[model samples]
Target: MNPGASQEPAQPTPGKHARHPKAGSISQPLLFAASTYALGQVANFLFQLRLLYLLGPSQYGETGLAHLLLVTLIFLADLGYSSLFLRESGNSPDWQHTWRYALGHRLAATTVLLAASALGWQLWGSEGASQEYLLWAAPACLLALFNYSSPMIAEGRRLAGLLVTQVAWPAALLFWYLLQDSLAQSMAATAGLSVSLGYLVQALVNVFCSRQLKLWLPLVGKGQIGAAVHLSLIGICGTLHDRLTPFLLAPLAPTFLPFFLILNHVLSGLSGIQAQLARLLLPTANTAPGQARILTVASLLLWGTATVLLAGLLIKDLALFTGQRPWLGLAAIVIFAWGISASSGVLATLLISARLEGRLMRLLVIGMTDSALLQIGAAWAGDAGYLLWARMAGVLAILVWQLKLLKLRFGLAGLTTLALSLLACVADATDWAMTIGTVLLLPILIGLLRQAPCYLPARRAGAHP
Candidate 1:
C-alpha cells in the first residue's frame, strides 16, 4: 500500500461539509484569522519601525528595495502552486501526489531564482547600497521554500496553523531587535537571519501538526508541473505590478522611496486583514454563493467605514510613526484603495473557486497594465502623492473589472460606497471638505449598521422562528 494512502475513514467530500470545521458560523474562523493576522501585523509594524530608525533613510531605502526583490523572486518561485494546492487538496484523493509535485516544482523554481539572482549580481556588479543589501539578502531566498510552502499546507488543511506560521517571522524580527543592537553585522544580514529562523519555525510547526495527514513528497508527480504553471500564469501580472512598482520607483525617485515604502507597507498591512478574511470566506463562496455575497458586501461596508474612522483616529500616530506630516488626501486614498482591494479579493476568490482563471488572467493583465502606465506617468511627474493617487486609479479599475467578471451589478449601496470614498478623497484635500463629507457619511454608516445583522449567520429555524 502507498504510504500516502490513509487507513482511517475516508474524508468527506471537500465542498460537502455542512459546516466549516470550526463552529457552524463562518464568521468564527474569520474572526480568529483576523485576530492572528492583526497580531502579526503589529509585530511586523514594530519590526519595520525599528529597522527604519536603525538604518536611517538611505540604508532603509536600500533594504526596502532588496526586500522587494526577494519577495518578488519568492513569489515567482512558488508560482501559485500553493493556491492551486489549497483549492485542489480538499477534493482530490491523490492530494499527496499533488503536494509532492508542487513541492518538486517549487524546489526547482527556487533553484532557478537563486541562480538568476547570482547571475544578475555577477554580471551587473555592485552598484551601491541596494546591491550591497541584495548580496546579504539573497541567502534568505532559501527560506522562501518554507516561507511559501508552509502557509499553503496550513491553509489547505483549513487550520489555524496558518496564523501561527504567518506570525513566526515578525515575532523573530522583534526578538532579534530587542536582544541585539550590535551594528557589527549588516542590517540586511540580521534581517535575513531573523526571517530564515522564522521560516524554519513555521515549517517545523506545520509539518508536526499535519503529521496525521501522512504527507509525502515523491520525486516527481505526473501532470503537477503543468497545472501549477497554468495557475501561476494567471497571477503573474498582478504579482509583477505589485513587486515591480518599488523597483521602478526606487531608481526614479530615490528620496521618496523610503516614505513610499512605509506608506505602501502600512496600506498593504491594513488591506491584508481584509484579504485574509476574504480568503477565509472563500470556502463558503464555493459552497454558498448567496451567503458569501452577503458576507462580502457587509465586510466591505464595515471595513470601509472602519478605515475612514481609523485613519482619522490614527492620523497623528501615523505621522509620528513615519516621522513625517500626515497627508489626509493620501490617507483617504489608502482607505479607498483598500476598500477596492478587499472587495476585489472576495470577488476574485469566488471566480477562482468557480474555475474562471482564464477570465481572471485577462482581467489582471489589463488592470495591471493600466495601473502600471498610470504609475509610470505619475513617477515622471515626480510627486509621491500623485503616485499614490495613480495607484488608487489602478485599484479602482481592477475592482470595476472584477465586478464585470463576477457580473455583480452595482446597486445603490455599492454606488454610495464608491461615491463616499471619492468624497473622502476630496475631504482629505481640504479641512472644510472633510466636515461636509463627515455629514454626508452619517446616513450611509447608519444604513450599513442597520443591514449588518442580516449578514450574520441565521439562527436555527426552531431557535429563531
Candidate 2:
C-alpha cells in the first residue's frame, strides 16, 4: 500500500436523508477505484474488439451465450450475498469481523460451486469439447470470490489492494493469452483464468490492506448476518440487472447473440458512467440533496447524450464491428438505447440510498419476467426485432410503473423521458420529423430537470456543504 498517499474517509451522515458534500467525500481511494474500473472496462471493450476479429459471428454468439451462463451461474453461486459486504463495509470502520464473515461465506460458496461443477460435469460435461470447456470454468468462478469483496475494501479508499487485482490480473491474462497457441481456447480460457487470478490477487491485497489499515469487521450476531444476507439478496438483483441480456438472446438466435451483446456492452458501458456518478453521489445525498441532484442530472444528461451520439454515429458500422451477421434493425437498436438511457444506474443507486433497493429488484423481476415473456413471444413470432420491441415495451412498463412507485410528481419532466423513448422509435423508422421534434424539445426538458432532485452541482474551491 502507498502509505504516503493521502487517504480521506466518507463518514456516514448523521441525518436520515442528508449527506456531507460528495466532492470532498469522493477521496483518492474512491477516485482510484472509479478510474481503475473504467480503465478495466475500456480494456475489456478493446478485448471484445479483438474477440470480434478472431471469433467472428457464430462463435461469438456461442461465446456470448457461454458468458451469459457463466454470469448467471456466478449469480447463483453467491446467492446474492456479496453486496452485503459492500454496504456494511462502507459503514463499518474496522473490518476484521467483516473479513471473517466474508472469508467464511466465500469459502462456503466456493465449496458449493466446486461440488456443483463436479456434478454438472458428470451429468453433461460430455455434451461437447466446447461444453467441457464451459464445465471447466467452474473452478475460476469459485475462486472469483476475491473480486466480490473489492468494492467492500475500496469503500473507504483503501484501494491499493483492489488496484493490484485490477491491474495485475489482466496483465497476467494477456501474457498467458499470447503464450497460448490454441485459438479455440484462447478467449474463454483466458477470461476464466484472468478473472480467477485477478480476484485471487485482489483477495490477498484486501487481507494485507485490512491489516495495515488496522481494520477489523465488527463481531456480530446471527441477526446481522441475516440482515446482511437480506441486503445482499437485493444487491444481487442489481448484478443480474446487467447480467441477463445475453441469456435472453441465446435461445433466440445464435447469430444475433454477439450483435446484441455488442449493443448491450455499449448500453452498459454508457450506463456505467451513471453508476460511477451514483456511487460518488449517494454517500453525499444524505447531506446535500440539491448538490447531489445536480451531479445526478448532469450524469444522466451526459450519458443520455452519448447514447444518442453513439446511435447516430455507429449504428451502421456496429454490425461490421461484430464480424457476425450484424443483426439488422435500427429500430431494435433504438429500443435498446432508449431503454438503457431511461433506466440509468444513477437512478438505481439513488433508490438504494432511499432504502428502496428491494423495490429496484422487485421492479427488475417484473421487467425480467416481461423480457422473458417477450423472448418467448418473439420466438413464436419468428421475427428479428420482436425481442427489441419486447425490451422496449417491458422497460417502458417498468419505467412507468417505477415512476408511479417513486411517485415522481415531475409531470412534464417524466413525460420527457417517455417522449424521448418514442422519438428513438421514430428515428428508427425514418420518422425524422418526430425525432427532430424530440431533439428540439431536449433543452426545455433539460431545464425541467432542475425540478427533480436527481442532479447535483459541481464542487468549487473552498466548497463546504
Candidate 3:
C-alpha cells in the first residue's frame, strides 16, 4: 500500500452502528460563527483601547512595529501553503495525510521566518530595541505560525477558540498592567510578554481542540505545492502593500509612525466588516446575475457610507482619547484615499465570483505599479506632505483603473457612495463638519441597517427590494 494511502481509514462494516466521516462534520452553525466573530472583534477593539492607555505612544509604537513585522513575515513565509491546505482538506479523502504534509511546509516556513526576523532586527533595529520584545515576540510568532492552517474543520468552534485567543492578550495585559509595580517590569515589556502568552494559550487550545493534529504525523506526498507557490506569487503585491507601508513610513517620519499604526488597526476593523459582508452576500450574488449587480451596488453604498462615518468618528474619538489630536487630519486623508481603494476590494470580490480573475489581475498590476511610481517619486523629492498626497493620488488612480478594467458603471446609489466617500476627506477640516457629517449620515445608516436583513433573502429570491 502507498504511504499516503496508509492514513486512509479502513472501511467500516455494514452494520447498525457503522459511521462514515464527512467533511465539515464538526463545523458549527452560522449563528454561532457570527456570534463568536462579533465577540472576538469587540474583545480586540477593547484591547486596542487598553493598549493605547497602558503603553504611552512611544512604547506602543515600538510594540506595534514588532507585532506587525512578525505578522507580515509569517504570512510572507507561509507563501499561501496554509490556504492551499485549507482548500485541499475539504476535498481529500484522507485529510490527515494532507495535514501532515502541510505541517511540514508550515514548519519549514516558520523556521525561515524566525531566521529572517532575527537577521533583519540585528541589522536594522533601532537602538531602543529591547531584549524583552524579542523574548516575547519570538514565541508569539512561532505559536501563531500554524494557527490558520489548523486541521480542524470546525469553523464555529474555531471562532470560539479564536475569541479565547483574542481575549487572552487583553486579559493578560490588564493583569500585567495592574502588577507592574510589583513586578518591576516596564509597560512595554509586560505588554509584549502578555501578547506572547496569549499566542501560547491559542496554540495550546488549538492542539487540544484538534485531537488529530500531532507533530508526529508522517509527512505525505507534495500535494499541489506548486499551485500554492503560484497563488502566493499572485498575491505578493497585496501582501507587500499591506505590510511594508509602515516600514517605509517609519524611517522617513518616525513621529508619524505611531499614528499610522493606530490608523492601520482601525482600517483592519473596517476590513473585517467588509470581509463579513462579502462572505455573507457573495454566495447569493453568484446565484443570480441580475441580482448580483443590484446587491453589489447596494453593498457598496451601505458599506462605503458606513465606513466614512465610522472612520471619521473613530479617528476623532481615538485622537481625543489618546491626546494625539494632531494626527486626526492625517487619519481623515488616509481614510478618504483608502475608502476608494476599499470599494475596489468589495467589487473585486463580487467580480471574482463572476469569473473575471484575468481582468482583475491585470487591473491590480497596473494599479500597484502606478501607486509604486507615485510613492517613489514623492520619496525621491523629499517632501513628506507630497508623499502623502501622492499616496492618495495613487489610490484614486487605482479606483479609476479598476472601474475601467471591470467596466463598472455606478448607478445613483453607487455615485452617492463615491461622493460621500470623497467628502469624507474634509471631515477633519473642522469639528462642526464632522458633527454635521455624522448627523446627516445617521438616518441613512439606520435605514440601511434595518434593510440589511431583507437584502440577503430578498435579493436571493430575485427581488431587489
Candidate 4:
C-alpha cells in the first residue's frame, strides 16, 4: 500500500450524498484555479488585441470562424462525459479505474466524431480560402482529445489542473505569436499552428500533472460507454444552444461575427468568477447545502459588482475596438445575462452534485431547445442588435427555469435577497441610476452580509467554534 494511503482518510463508499473534501482542505487549489482563470483571461484579451492589430477585422474573422468550428467539433466530441466522470469519481476509492474509464470513453468518442467531421469535410467541402483555413484548423480536434482529459481528472480531484492546462495553452499561443512575428505570415496558418501547438503543450502538462497526482489510465467497462454517450448528447445540445447565434450569423452576417466573438469572449472573461465559485462549491453542494448556498449568493454579489465596474471602465475601449456603439447594449445584456446565468449555474452544480443530473439534463434540453429556436428567429431578422437581444432573452428563460428549480429545492426565502440584488444591478447600468439604486439597495446588501453566518454550516463541537 502507498505510505500516504493509511494517513489519509479512507474513501467513503459512494452513496446518494458522498462525502466531500472540506473547503479549508482544498483552499489552495481553489485559489490557484481562480488566479489562473483571471490571468488566462488577461492573456487572451491581450492576444485578441494583438491579433486585431496584426490581422485586421477581415482576417481575424476568418481565424474566428476556424476556431469556432474547431470548438464546436470538440464540444460535440465531449458528450458530457467529463462532468459525468467528475460526479461519479467524486469520492470513489479506485482512482486508477475511474480515471481510465473516463479517459477511454472520452478518447473513443472524440476519435469517432473527429473522423466523421473530416470525412464530411472531404465529401462536401468548401473551396479556396475557407477550405484552406479549415484544413489547417482541423488538427486542433485531435489535440483537443488530449487537452480535455487532463482537466477532467484535475476537476475530479478538485486540484489546480485547470490552472496548469487552461492557462498554459493561451500563454503558449501568445508566445508562439510573438516568436513568429505573425504579422507577416498568413493569419490563418499562424492561428491554426499556434492553437494546435498550444494544445499539444497543454496535453503534455496535463499528463504530467495527472501522473504526479497518481492517476493512471486503465481499461474501460462496457457500462461506462452507454452512460457517457447519453450524457454527451445532452452536453452537445447545451453547447449548440450557446453557440447558436454565432453559427447562424457566420453564414448570414459574416461581418458581424468577429465583433460578436470578441464581445462573447469579454463576457466569458467576466463570468470567470462564477466559474471559479462553481468549481469551489461543486464538492460541497450536496454535502453542505447551506454553506454552498451562502457562497453562491456571495459570489453573485461580487460578480455583479465587478461586472458594473469592468463594464464602465472598458465600455469606451470596447466600442473603439469593435467600432460599434451598439456593442454597449450588447455588453450590458451580456453582463446581466452572465449575472443571472451564474446564479443558475450554482443551482445546477448543486443539483448535479446531488445526483440529480438526469432532471437537470431534461431541463437543459427543454431550455436550450427554446433558446436555439428563439436565436434562429432573431438571426433571420438580420440585425446584430436584435440577435444579441434574442440571445439575452434565451439566457433569461434558462435563468428563470433554474431559479424555479432552486425555489423548489431550497425555498423562496433564501433567494429573496438574491432577487433584490439582481434587480439593483439591472438598474445600475448608468451612473445616475446606479447611484440611486445603490442608495436604495445598501440596506439589503448590509443585512444579507450580516446574516451570512446563518447560511454557513454550523461549527462542530471542539472545533473552530
Candidate 5:
C-alpha cells in the first residue's frame, strides 16, 4: 500500500466499517461561561432597576442620552478595527505585533477623546443639562477606554476584567447612591465616581498583568503606526452598530428616548454575554477540535430561539412598550438580530482563523453601506420603529452576503425561523398564542430532525448524531 494510505485498518467484515479515531471533548468552559453570564444578567438588571427607580423618568432620560452619546463616542474613538486586530492575534499567537499596534491606536484615540471632552467643557461650561452630571462623566470616558484592553487579556489567557469590574462598579455606585438627597443627584454623582473608580481598578490590574507577561511596552516603534491605522480601520466596522445608536436616537422624540436607551442597555448586557462567547471561541477554535463549526450552528439556533421567544413575550406586555405598538417593526428587529448571529461566522471566526482581511473587509464594506442606507430609511419612517426596520433590513443583507462568502447552507430550521420571525414582525399576534404556536412548530421543524449532515457526525440508524 502507498505510505499515505497505509494507515487504513485491516479489511472489515461485511456490513461493518472501520471506526475512525475521534477527537476528545470537554465542555467545562462553555458551562462556566453560560452560568456566569446568566448570573451576571440577573445582577445587572437589579442594579439598573435600582437606578431607574431612584432617578425617575426625566433625569433618567437625560442621563440615558448622555450615556448613549458616551457609548457612541467611545465606539468612534475605537475606530472600527479592534475586532480584526483581536481576531488576528487570537488566530495566530505569533503575530506578536498585533497587540502593540492595537494598543497604540487605542491610546492615541483615547487621548484625543479626553482633549475633545475637555474643550467641550471649557466652551459650554455647564450651559446645557449635561453639566450637573459633569463630575460623573469625565471618569466614565477613561474607564471605557481602559475596559477595551480587557479583550487583550480575554483572548490571551481567557482572563477578563469585566466580571470583576461588573460587580465592583455597581457596589461602588450603590455606595454613592446611599448619600444623596433625591434620586437624580444621587444617580448623577454615583455614575461619575463609580465609572472613574471602576476604570481605575481595571487599568491598575491590567498594568500588573502586563508586567507579568513581561510586555516591553516601550519597544513599539514607528513601523507600528501604519499597522495601527490598518487595524484601527477594521475596528471601525466592528463597532459601527454601537457608534450609530446616538445618531439614530438624537433626532427622535426626546420623551421616548430614555425607554429606548434602557431597552438598548438591556440588549447590550445580553449581547455582552454573547460577545464573551464569541471572544472565547474565536481564540480557542485554533487548538480545539470542531469548535468553529459547532458554534456557528449553535449560534443560529440559540439566537433564533431567543429572539423569537423574547419578542413573543414582550410584544403584548404593556410595560415594555412606552407608547404605540410597533409590533411588526419590533419583530423585524428580532429576526435581524437572529440572522446576524448566523452571519457572524464569516464576519468573525472564519475570517479570523483564515487571517484574511481582504474578504472580511470587502464583506464589511458592503454591510456598512446597507447600514447607512437603512439609517436613511429609518430617518424617513420617523420613529424608533423605522430605525428598527432599517436595522433589520441591514442585518439580513449582511446575512445573505456573509453566507455567500462562506458557501454555507442553512437547513429547514434556520429558514423556518427566519420566515416566522418575518411574519411575526409584519403581523400582530397575541403573546401566549404565538408562544404555543412557535413552541409546537419550532421543535417539529428543527428539534426533531436534528440534522447537520455537512458538519456534525452521522446519525446511527434512527437516532440523531
Candidate 6:
C-alpha cells in the first residue's frame, strides 16, 4: 500500500455520511482523473461520430443498441463481486488475495453469461456470424470489468492503472477504426470485433504496468458469494433504471429509437462529470469518518443540477441545427430524468460508502418495480411521449425516496437550480424561443450565484448536525 494510506476502513456511525478528505490531499488525483477521463471520452465521442458518418443513422442506432446490450450483460455477469471487493478490501493487508477470490467468481459468472449470450444469438440473431462478434465482445467486457475498480481500490495513491484503462482503450479503439479500410460484415458486427481488439490491447498494457495477469483462484467461500450477490442486486436494479428507456423504446416505437439513442449518446458524455465526481469522492468515504456537511451536500446537488441543465440546453440547439426539431419534447423529458438521476446517484454513493448498500438496494428494487409498471402502461398507451413521461416520473419517484432517506431538502440554492432546470425543459418541450428561456432563467441563475457563498471554505466549519 502507498505510504499513509489507511489500513482499515473508516467506520462512521449509522445514519451519517462519510467525511470529506482535505481538499489539497484529493486535488491531484481529482485533477488527474478528471483530465484523463475527459480526453478518453472525447476519443470515444469522435469514434461514435465517425461510426455514425460511416453507417448512417439507422445502422448507427443498431450498433449503439448492441453496445448497450453487451455492456449490460457484462454488468450482470459481474454479480457485484468487484463492488464487494472495493467496499471490503480497500484497506485489507491481503488485498491481492481478496481480489483474486472476487476475480475467480467474476470469471465463472462471465463464462455462464457468455454461453447464454451465444445461445440467445444463435436462436434470435438475424445476421450470420454475429455470434462470432459476440465472442469478441466478451473479452473486451471482461477486461473492462477487471479494471473498473482498480483506481478506486488504489485510493488515488497510484493512478497508472487508471491512466491505462481510461486513455488506452478508447484511443486504441479509435485508431483501429481509422485503420479499417471497409467493413466486411455489418457495421455492428465490425464494431464488436474492433472494440474487442482494443480491449485486448488495453489488457496487455495494464498487465505490463502491473507486472501480473493473474485472474481466478479457488476461493469460493459462501460468505463471499452471499455478500457479492447482495451488492449485485443493487447494481442490476440500477441498470434497469438506466437502460430501461432504450429497451422499452426499441420494440414499441422502433422509428423513434434512433433519435433517443442519439440523445442518449450525447447525454452520456455529459454524465461523465458526475461519474468522475463519485469516483473521486468514494476514496474519501473509504478513508474518512463523519457526516457530510450541509454545504457539501447542497453543492453536490447544485453542481449536478447545473450540469444537466446546461447539457440539455446545449443539446436542444444541436438538435435544432440537425433538423431534429420534432424530438425536442422527447429531449426535454430525457434531460429532466437525467437531472433527477444524477442528484440521486450522488446521494446513493454516499449511502453505499456508509455501508448502507442493503438499504439502498431495497429502495432501488422498489423504484424499479414502480418503473416497470409505468413503462408497461406507457407501452400499452402506444404513445412515445407518454412512455418517456412515465419513465421520468419513475426516476422522480426514486429521487423523492432517496431524499427522505438522506433527510436532504431543497434549500434556496437547490430550489433555484431546480427552477432553472425546469425552465430549460419547458422551453425545449414547448418550442419556445431560446432567448425566452435564457431571459426567464436569469433571475433564478442570479439567485443561485448569490447562494454560492454557502459552499465556500468558511461555510464548512464545525460538525454536521
Question: TM-score for every candidate vs. truth?
Answer: 0.78, 0.70, 0.72, 0.72, 0.72, 0.80
Q: Is candidate 2 or candidate 5 better by TM-score?
A: 5
Candidate 3 lDDT by residue in tens digits, 146-236: 4532233233234443344344455555655565676656655665676667677767766665654564353746855555555454355
Off by over 4 Å in 3: 1-35, 41-55, 81-86, 89-91, 129-131, 148-186, 215-221, 233-236, 251-253, 276-285, 289-326, 350-366, 382-385, 399-407, 430-465
Q: How many pairs of residues collide in each model?
A: 0, 22, 0, 3, 10, 0
Clashing pairs in 5: 79-236, 80-234, 80-235, 80-236, 81-234, 81-235, 81-236, 82-235, 136-192, 328-425
Please list the Cα RMSD from the true structure of every candidate, rounded to 1 decimal place.
7.7, 8.4, 9.8, 8.0, 8.1, 5.8
Q: Report residue 4 deviation for candidate 2 (angstroms).
A: 40
Looking at model 4, residue 242 earns an lDDT score of 63
Model 1 C-alpha lDDT per residue in residues 1-465, reported as the tens digit of each score: 232222321111212222342222346655675556666666666766777887898888867766666667877888777666555544457766666666677778888988887687567454555565566556556554553333454355444644654655575675577546765666656665665566566666656655633453434655466556666876667667766567666676677678777877776666556656555555565555434443444445444654474345334334354544355455566566656765666557666656666667778888888899998899789776677778879977887667555544455556666766676666554546535655665676665554432122212345220
Q: What's the TM for model 6?
A: 0.80
What tens digits encode model 6's per-residue C-alpha lDDT throughout 171-197? 546646664667566554666667777
Instruction: Compose the digit string of candidate 5's lDDT tens values, residues 1-465.
Output: 121121211111111111211231225665365345545455445645655676776666655655555555666665444454454434556444555555556557776876776576556343334444555656656555443344454455444533543443454455455555445454566565654564566556666644535332423445335433444554466566544644575567555555566666666665656655554555554443434334343444434553554455444445655354544345446445644544463235544444444556667777877787777677767876677666767766766666555444444445655665555554444546456444545553454244322222222356322
Task: Please report how far candidate 5 places residue 429 from its true position, in Å.
Answer: 5.7
Candidate 4 local lDDT, 12-74, one digit each (tens): 111111133232222555556555666767666666666666677777765555555666787
True-structure lDDT of candidate 2: 0.49
Of 2 and 3, which scores higher on TM-score?
A: 3
Please, what is the whole-model Cα lDDT of each candidate in the order they appear?
0.60, 0.49, 0.55, 0.56, 0.51, 0.61
Q: Would you list the clashing residue pairs of candidate 4?
A: 79-232, 80-232, 100-218
